[model samples]
Target: MFFVILLAQTVIGQKITGTVYDDTKTPLPGANVYVKGTSKGTTTDFDGKYEIEIDAKHQVLVFSFIGYKTKEVKVKGKTIVNVTLEQDSATLDEVVVVGMAESRMMKREHVVGYSIARIPQNTESYAAIKENDFKDVIKNPLSTFSVDVDKASYSNVRRYINNGGLPPADAVRIEEMINYFNYDYKAPKDDAPFSINTELSACPWNKDNLLLHVGLQGKKIPMDDLPPSNIVFLLDVSGSMNSPNKLPLLKSSLKLLLESLRPKDRVAIVVYAGSSGLVLPSTSCKDKKTIIEALEGLSAGGSTAGGEGLKLAYKIANENFIKKGNNRIVMATDGDFNVGLSSNSEMERLITEEREKGIAISVLGFGMGNYKDDKMEIIADKGNGNYAYIDNLLEARKVLVSEFGGTMYTIAKDVKFQLEFNPVHVSKYRLVGYENRLLNEEDFEDDTKDAGEIGAGHTVTALYEIIPSKNNSDKENRLRYQTSELTSQALESNDLITLKLRYKKPEKNKSLLIEQSVQNKPVAFTETSDNYRFSASVAEFGMLLRDSKYLGTATWKSAYMLAKDAKGSDEEGYRGEMIRLIKSAELLSSNKQE
Candidate 1:
């Protein structure tokens, strides 16, 4: 009887295990195997085998893997639980950040006809998108210009919430750039150029904002062992970041980032408040438990000390810089660098030095109310990084994970656009957007001129409204030479305008050029292509919102009505969101003029 009891105990103590594989039968390493949320999880070994302790405690086991989605299975009182992950088709929204601004949707086109007024040439400016023709309002507003979707490549997108569970106004937000499409982008199958397809049909609401049909085909990143990444989490625990929307949302955002990291990566935490200090030394990705614990203990307090924080972060990053691995300092804050490096020049100098050492920076702006937009711009620009504002969780997912390549990896830096107008077919022309990014025509050919960067798969779009010289009607709008003074005889006869683009390949100091021309044709604004229609909507929206003081007779209602009429079905639902946002804005302000 004792021997029988011993045998039974031995049998009960036996471990049950199996390997987890994908549909391809490939061993899935690093898969998470957990029994609910008991803080107990065992990762599969290199061979994907698990010898986890099994008692009467667990009836269902959960399996999760990144990119492949997640799953759960009931053991049925048995011992083994094998999981197969399916790709999550319902992806999150993308965050689209270009240069130093939020890419927004626009609704009007500024057609340049010969203006009888002193300004001449129909101008597309803050005057075009203003809300109330108010000088200050027109010059600066919440958002400006249409996102470069049709032109640029997908960079990132935020996670999706059911039925619009977006983050609060003060939280950080990002959108998933590729959720709108399905890309099987494989490295050029045979080194031929890979191309994505995009098309447009008539727009529903606004016939002008035509429906967009895009199918992108691109070369894929060949599967290879990625260089080990060394990441420094430079967090802002400043007093201004104490709001629930700031610190709490920031924590959740970083947690999402932690989830995306692989076991081979290393992360170090450096935090700043009244001053800066290292919270956690660099640790392997496998040490997720300790890292998460440190993250949870973080609290927001004390005045901001950005200078101190940056120095310490650089020190830690330099200590662990990888020869070829990614070394990035992700700074999260509202760009309030007071108490230290308060001046832009000093901060610029420090960041410049760090950039020279190949330590890149990515600035994530959090919180509002006391948000410092100008500071964020300066840091991101000089830090060799870009700036993004997270108004919600969606933005977090976009920035951290979606289209990670484009946002984190640049294709070309210092891209500049220059257009030389011809006096022949076109009497005059007006550039529709990019008031801030404008460069002198001479800079278009100069590689040394500081310009914008473009990421892999990024497409850039710029538009101009032309006035055909044949139409005597526009003769009034052209900025007539006060006395035909400046132009030499040779300069007086050039077609409509020549658009020039200059850019440098990533890691290359030299520049390349591309040019296209437009003849002043009978093409009226209404007669332009779908691309023009969509672009017009963008320009008009900017003008109405800025409340340009130059808006003599135009009003918000008219602009909104035009946009509503031009907006299409918007199967993606972006158009619908626009209607809601605009309507809400109209209602929020006291100046409601029907």
Candidate 2:
């Protein structure tokens, strides 16, 4: 009898194995499988096969994948349990709405009324981005662009990689990817809002050219010293946000942010769907339970009236304006604005006008299919605010809790950079990213012109790939009428470039100018600081992803190696995560080739 009992226990301890498939019986790779009610989980391999050890106590298993409905199975003494998840019809119907907008002449009201159970979902959304091209320094000597502190692109790209796919080329914004990782630049010493650091080194991808890295470090503000905040949460509880990863994830994300709020801070809730309404009046942070209940009670329904919601949110913020304190509106949505003032230009005008009234807007993007990335980006850019995409709960914590100061407080506004390359030293150059943020040469000195804003404790980095004047291979043809000779002063100067920065204090209208010159001294790549090396690695990675024509010899292997070596003092493990992401991307690329 003892031997029989031992044999039964051994048989029961065997691992449970199964395959996950879609409705058409096609295997789903990278699907998440785990024991229900626990963190123990494993992802399906390339063949969609998963194995998990089930103990006597854990009898339930859950299977989930992006764009598919989740499935839960009870073991019930079964050894093998296969799951066939149905395509999430809701997301698919929304994809139709995105593509059929003009063809069906469907307005917001008609589209919102379509049932989610109509189709099978298949689509990816990304803002259209036009890459920058190299310019002759002799003709276009100055490069000017606003500083973008938004890190949405980095996390959004990661979401694609983690789901076993490569991000759309336009989605890979190199500057955001590099700025997502904080650098160890020196802090500001005097009354200046930020300090600038510049480094020039031999380009890793092309040994013939040089790479110039410019970094800006914003002054750090301790959490306790931050001003009291008067915040309005503009949430989108529209019908489209009914997915598990949309509304539910947003609620959980906001709760994490609430944990970091102080008693002196006050928050109000404004929701939009069909029409706009105030869900919770301005209440002190000490009333955490009431705020949480308000967030929980929000349900998805009706068409989205994002413009009305924004108007109401700004009105509340203006009413409760905190002098010398942080008065901001946090707009959380999927960026699908279908009602009044839904056009991009109209939304931009609304947010820009409201921002001028001292209430900044920070946009938190959620969801995937039917996501309006272009609209979200424009709203943040025009509203004197920042934008971040919350793809998962962990990213939520990073943006809202870990970097609260940087996300909520604006230290500098209309920050701009203009680099004047010496015609004698550089022949041609290209700014790695910021294609959309480029400013006119005259716009740098215009205080009234809108530009990017830097939050407290935020760091912005920009890179320029330069071809020296001696490199005749990449030079532009000399004009027949104009002289090709450099000026006597340009020939005599030792300066390679002049970096000019213009920024306005958070409340001031006028701008302050700071100028610095960098000498033409290129250091070996290995001797450069970890900040320079790591940023170069990220830029190279982006170029490879974009299939850039300027990518002379950049490869995924080289980028991965460089990033892995220069990951110094990665306290937050963000750098380490980049290394892993590169590996996955490399594998995906190779698989495509095969």
Candidate 3:
């Protein structure tokens, strides 16, 4: 009898089991079940079933899932403790507001005397954008701007279209839309990090203007040859992220990335809600199971302390920094920072400071309605990193798995492009996009001026619309007091523009310059390569969505046909998807017009 009692006591201390459910009695798969105050935990399986070993000192079991209030039950010497969590009212209200906004059933700003916190959650979030205007080539000959490789806007807009609505104009970033699709540019040949390709063709939208397409292709590095990585996952577990599409999806997305990590790589996890804390210290990729367990145990709650989380994540990344290796922080959030150090400026300053220590920051935006895209974009821009939106598992795979090297490893930094249009060939010109990335003409040659970074196997594209000098109908009159004249050499030259590219090695501060002069070689729009046609289609689509004043004769049907024709060897189906989206948008726009 004494031996039997001792064995039973040992079994009781060794294990505890439970099932977790939401208010509607639906099984909450992926819900976290753990002993309070301890790292020992396990996630509920598909059936909401979980079994975790318990230490004798740990007398309480905690059950948690995003969007549901967390529940803690004292063991009290019980063998089983099933839990049902109530829906968090604040989160439900936010979801309701998002639904109303999507349906256009109500205006969030109609509530009188409402504070920001109390304002209807229906207010969709987007950054303000002012489109670029035409520049007189004689007066403003130099067009300089940083390269932007971020593709968040494309996926975010897709999410809206897929949900049966057109995206807000401010959400449609033309540069990002053009960059999302891969182009068939030539690969780098030598020690240079990337190769540049240029093509000039007649503009499809505006018959009077010509389009100049510039492309950059980064050298590809084999996965086996990639350096060891030191990555810290800065995850937001605040109340705002307590939704099915936020925290839960984020965990699943990170798991896909974990499958790509090698034994030489290391990972750390830092989670923040009302406060910040390190859940897992730096661990080798070989111990993936342990790392995954830590991720599965995380549950969203409380307010967002994003600044605090950023600091802690950067500290962890710095501590485990590897020389000549990929050191970065992958931040997954909805961009809602309501508590401690929540201001955009403060967050930007923190990211900028940390990036100087050689740790890049890649932001993965999730959720909608309350998303702070402006904040996310700025953080990634200043942090020497890239930004992508993960709307679903496929997009997560695209960013975290398929484009691993290009998304995480940097080969070149501070990349800027400057173009000088010759008055002899071009009368007026305007950059198609990159309004926010514009830089001072002098900043192009300044090595200290920060710009965008290029990763392995990455590609950057830019477009310009130019009016020929022969077509002088829109030309401005010469200054009344001063006579503008071109040199004999300029008059004899056939060069339309001189393109100059400046970039620095990932580890060096010195910049390298590459210059190429484009002559008056114009091809018909239909005779252009698939790269030119596809990119032009994307830009035209963006203009139509924004209802830009500059969009002359651009129609959805034309953009759709162009995209379908130029969908070349799209192994990833991204180009095909764009065609379908264009069709959907056309229908939506037509319905609205009716």
User: Which residue window of length 10 is worst by lDDT in model 2?
Assistant: 91-100
RMSD value for candidate 1:
15.1
Candidate 3 structure, TM-score to reference: 0.80
**Considering TM-score, which of the candidate structures 1 and 3 is the better prediction for this target?**
3
For model 1, state the Cα shift of residue 336 in Å: 2.0
* TM-score top scorer: 2
Show where candidate 3 strays beyond 4 Å: 1-121, 471-477
Q: Give the Å error, residue 196, model 2.
A: 0.4
Score each candidate by Cα lDDT: 0.52, 0.82, 0.83
lDDT of 1 by residue, 1-594 (tens): 999986665456334576776554645654556554333346565455666554444445666543344566666456665666553422111111111121121111211110122222321111111122211111111112212221111111111111112322212111112122223333324642233332333332233322332222333332143356788999999888877657887888888888768898899999999989999999998999999999999998899898899999999999999876667788888766669878878888888788767677877776544666556655766665666667555556656665454445454566665555444344433443444444554566676566655434444444443333453343333345442222453235443445455566555678876555533332343543433343344444444444434333434465456555555544433443333334333433222342
Backbone Cα, N, C clashes tallied per candidate? 82, 1, 0
lDDT of 2: 0.82
What TM-score would candidate 2 get against the native? Answer: 0.82
Q: What would the per-residue lDDT of candidate 3 be over residues 280-390, giving only the tens digit for each residue?
A: 999999999999999999999998999899999999999999999999999999998888888888887888888788999999999977888988999899999999998
Residue pairs in candidate 3 whose N, alpha carbon or C atoms collide under 3 angstroms: none
